[model samples]
Target: MGGDFGPRVTVPAAIDALRRHPSLRILLVGRQEQIDPLLSHCTSIELDRLAVVHADSVVAMDEKPALALRRRKDSSMYLALQAVADGRAHACVSAGNTGALMVLGRGILQTLPGIDRPAITSAVPTVNGHCYMLDLGANVDCTASHLLQFAIMGSVMVRAVENIDRPRVGLLNIGAEEIKGNEQVRLASRLLAEQKQLNYVGFVEGDGVFSGRADLVVCDGFVGNIALKSSEGLARLISRKLRRSFGLNLYRRLLALLARPVLQELQAQLDPGRRNGASLLGLQGIVVKSHGGANRSCFGYALDQAVSEAQMNVPERISEQLELDLQSRDGSVKTF
Candidate 1:
């Protein structure tokens, strides 16, 4: 992993991962000194299954992806991906520089054929249950056709991971009516509405995200990213307010005793770990992204999500469904 804190942060997360997923084999890629002690922490970790590839380069959170990727040949993120491309590992994941990671991932792993552009997508928890939002921060500026493809990809993803049958898709816009928003959203709405393979639920306002109306929400990366961060911030703010309320006064404290169950449930509802782990969906291999600020529990959840995606063969399923659905419409590529 190309981590900012190197071994100090990764080692503990690694130990927790091993406890949670004994089947998880790690290729620890960092400065040897930084990673060696981490391996030592886990006495139960099978030394044979674990390996290290030394990489001295680390990408800063704000570095230019293209420049860093071009210059940093020995970066840990680069090596982790190389391991996948070389068939040394089945998948690669990083919680480092997201921008750099995206650049290196596409450069090394390449996009799936017929995909307009690989999107950095993640499933977020909805009030009803769970749904996915795509291009969370990958492509901020997207075309009408790109949004259509995102809707298709997001639908396939919800199917593979969440087992949703005929997932309802919504185009993110200023208003619920099809007449609202920019030309891109308007045009994308048309394409999505016409897609016989998709369950297009029509234009959804931003408020509908938490309203649990759509199983898949598609939008330009900038808006989606803003939504993700804003939601996370709101969850935190709400949690703090509840905690403050619980600790306020004598009668309030007595009331808080009665409200404990409700508070706990609300807390769990807002916790990021309970929500779906962020995923780099369009990559060649399954890449589950944890929050950069993830705790050991969150990292563990991400590891579980990765294992589940790998077992489900989500990437292949997505590719298969996409080819069949797109080809069926074009009538060029035969699909079974």
Candidate 2:
């Protein structure tokens, strides 16, 4: 009962995930009437692995986060997270109101020890495979401490999920020069460098994000959100131009036909759908936010992200790393 297609897309994606992961179980928390009709075609085995816990309402896409948190306790988004908090579910995945999800997630599941706020982190296609970027519209006005927390959480996440040891961390900035960015970035840079556990490589420019200069890039939500949206728009523009250019004439059409496999591979590599989930890092429980406009396959990827985070015990690992790094600091900055 969230996103553009509601149960129409989510149900099939959930079923497909169940098919792909034999050990997975899904609880469809939504209005039973709307969800039941969509599942009429599910087989008995699929039904056995799936259950529907009726929710009285849903958080609207544009609903105010605070208001929804205060009033819409029975909404599908709220209930889904409640399932995670109650230990009935390992993780919660939603393509609903992002603000509402964050507010309710923090309220119920709570943030990890020593974490002030949860940052939204996701992968973007890079010269390497991809690099994780954080604070993508979670907190627009982040403190230097907040940025440090984001880096720690992102480094932990990359190590756990990507199995990379000593993942390089970079603070997103205007330039590599020491005097390029504002005070927050500069302070965050110094703070990051002091952490011996982090392989901090100093500042990274916007262009460096995809150059594989660093495995994790941290920034305030204002800049990170704009950068992500701009990248997405540019990717769309490039794809459209490619399609139009190849269909211009019979000669180009023949060329496109011959190059279909190559084009398909390129598309697969850059497809945003392949990286649809954005983890709300720093939270005590696993909560993944799917794009509100995501399709069935894209939503399934979000589910996969939640499952992976849960299996890896991301929150515990992050908390442990934070304690180790923050404790080692000589009380100059109060992280905990």
Candidate 3:
């Protein structure tokens, strides 16, 4: 986890994470002063399971990528990445610098065999039910080819997790018109339409993100990042509004007592941390990007989600589907 207040959050998060999941093992990497107390605080059984690497450096959120990596080779984040690459761990979960995570994850795990670029994927619930979005924020400036690759990964996720056959996909564009977008989006539209493996539903607008216009929403990271943040902000605002309504008066307070469970259910639905984090797709191993501000409950949720993703074998499924898509195309790296 990368943050200015590492001990304050990471320590508590790790403790709660262990309490929530009895079988989960954690490898704490940070300065001894920061990591030791947390490890000591864990239950005796959990303490036996907890290990530390005594990493002495850290990369701040604003530190430039090259500068952080060059100056802090033994940083906790770097050591954690090394654990994944060295096969010491099945997956790595972090609430740290995203770009640094992506950079380090790529350096260690590398991209999947057929994927041209790594995409960030997340499960998004629609008005109807749960679905997913790909390239949520990693590649801000995506190419037509990158979007196509994201579609493939998203399809695999839906099938493997939701058991959906030939899941439908939608491109996030200015208009549904075939040629309505900029050069990259326009080109991507054509590519998605031609991909036989995908159930491409054509272009969709931001309004349709959770309206069930499609099972998967694909976009460049810049737009996808904005959409994710907007959804999160709106969810929080709506939750606060509901709470205020319940808190209005004596009668409302009584009503609030009755409505507490309902509100809690709704808040759970909108809880960004409840969903925990987005999976970095098209990588050789699973790397969950938990929110950098995550606390104990949030970290536990992330660990649970990461376990599910690992058990689903997302990396293997992505590789298999991409290879099948590629091999079916006359044995060449042809355009989608």
Candidate 4:
């Protein structure tokens, strides 16, 4: 109901996800008229695990977050979030308006203790597997304290989801040198270095993001968003160029056939759809934001993320870690 394709894509993806995970159940919140046609294709067993919760409205893609929050009370996006907030669902996943999702998610679920705001976080494929990065576009402007908070949450997320021990965290900057970044970044770097619980690896440049110098890279939303979009554009450009080059002549076409397997592997690594879901970290409840333009396969990947995060109990883990860190700072446990 929220995405470009609405139930056409989401329903099939949900059914596919349900088939893959035997214990998984889904509460599809959207207009019943639009959703029923799609669910009609599901088998009786699949239907047993899926339930539809009708939502009469939907947030427009271009709608302002504040406006959507104020007006769209019965929207699919809002109701999906409400399901999570009301304890009817373990997590919420949407390929809808990102801004509205963030606004409503915060308004309803609230942030975890010690967290002032939720950050948009995601995993990017790197030379060494992948790296967890945040704030992808949540807070455009951030203070030193905010950046420090991002690092803590990101470190906890990577360790919980990826099973990395003492995940190395790096602050994104113009240069790797300690004195190279802006005052806010430098301040965040200092704060991060002082945290013994974190494996703070200092500053990393744009190139270092893919080089896997750190398991987690933290930045304000402005820079993080630009970097993410630029990387996606570049990956597409490279893939297109390769296809054109390979199809230029008969000899090249023959070469492409021989190299098909290797090229397929490379394409899989660079496909944005493979890592389709971005976690809205710092919120008390789990909410995964899928790419609005994602297709059925891509949407399935996002559902996979929601399932994994729910199973890992990421928010609770992060809250526990934050509490421990706060307690270590003083002899007494500080309330957040």
Clashes of each: 0, 0, 0, 0
Listed per candidate, the RMSD to the true structure in angstroms reads 3.2, 1.9, 3.0, 2.0
TM-score of each model, paired residue for residue? 0.88, 0.94, 0.85, 0.94
Summing lDDT over every window of 10 consecutive residues in candidate 2, give the lowest-scoring window: 327-336
- Pairs that clash in candidate 4: none
Off by over 4 Å in 3: 3-24, 41-48, 235-261, 334-336
The candidate that achieves the highest lDDT relative to the unseen native structure: 2
How far off is model 2, as Cα RMSD? 1.9
Residue-by-residue lDDT tens digits, candidate 1, 1-336: 544444666667766666667687877777787788667746654665578899987777788999877987788888888887787877776778888888888888887766757787776778777777888989989998889778877787787777778999988889987678999999988878877889999987878887888998999999999988998888788878977977889999999999888978877876766653677777777666666766655666766677777767777877887787766678543211
On a 0 to 1 TM-score scale, where does candidate 2 land against the true structure?
0.94
lDDT of 4 by residue, 136-167 (tens): 99999999888988999999888888889999
- What tens digits encode model 3's per-residue C-alpha lDDT throughout 33-77? 766755655667878767887787887887776666667688888
